[model samples]
Target: MPCDFLPAQRALLDATEHLIYTGGIHATGVDAIVRKSGIARKTLYRHYPTKEALVEAALRRRDDRWMAWFIAATSGYTDPRARLLSCFDALREWFASDGFHGCAFLNAAGEIGPATHPIRAVSRLHKRRLFEYVCTLTRETGLAQPDEIAEEFLVLIDGAISLALVFGDTHGADAAARSAQRLLRHIPVSS
Candidate 1:
């Protein structure tokens, strides 16, 4: 069923995200977005002056959705260490889901080559925010170098996602989570 409750701009962004994820960003044009969104060309143009703008908006929406899902998935664990490992559990679920087309940020980065591209910037921001969240979890474990450990954890997370995408298997998350558990072993949990 169509989500008529969403605002027109949000509806457009959601449609664009679906199209861009299923189809390549370059392959999904404004006309396609219009047809998918069921919105008029004038309205789409008025809301987003250019395709790049629409792509950025779609990415931002994706970033919000992804983060919220991640946080919620990881929130059930009471232990800080378990919470940290839950990141991978979340990835496993996401990978096995219906629309598992790899990381949207990575896809956008590839599609928009320039480092300075607005979509690339959104992708980078999403990654940095994820790193920050990991850092928060690391700090809770009383790790001496939360920043450095968080950086390493981020690499594991991204690597797992990439591998899962490449090999068409969710075991990457398990491998990454195992590595994460080893890394957390030395650190003392805060009382």
Candidate 2:
């Protein structure tokens, strides 16, 4: 959903996203969100009836923000191939950003137990959107198997994020970019 949040509601979501991103979803509570937001408990609940609902909204907001930033980061290059490879450049910047804990969707999905949970569903949707965007880029490059190349690229993207989080390896994205270049070299371009 587009963030058409009221001032108070936006505050609540900003606080929720920060706390959850830095501290994990299960560990962060409504009380902390209320306090951090400086919005009264009643107001928080008024905006989001349940804690889960607030989390969902916050994750949605994060998804919108992350995707916009990512698209902007990669969209500058005119060449489809450069634009595709710029994905890793974007990741490198994100991995180095302050309070970068890893992919928000992955973190939220990990904390939630049920496969059918709304939070997990949101996570899946975020990944699906990202993958679809990659597909568009690969197809634009005239790759013979754009879908297959997209799948490999998405794996590299996820692997870079995971390795960066686990090892504090700032160069993970660079390595992923190199691997992507190698993958592109092997894949036959369409006539």
**What value of lDDT does candidate 1 attain over all alpha carbons?**
0.87
Q: Which ten residues in a row have the lowest lDDT in candidate 1?
A: 1-10
lDDT of 1 by residue, 1-191 (tens): 12343477877898999999988799999999999889998998888899889998888878877888888898898887788889999999988888788999998898887899899999999999899998988887676788888999999999999988898889999999999988888766555
Clashing pairs in 1: none
Error of 1 at 78 (Å): 1.7
TM-score winner: 2
Q: After superposition, how far is residue 173 of candidate 2 from its true place, in Å?
A: 0.4
> Which 10 consecutive positions of candidate 2 have the poorest summed lDDT?
1-10
Instruction: Provide the clashing-pair count of each candidate structure.
Output: 0, 0
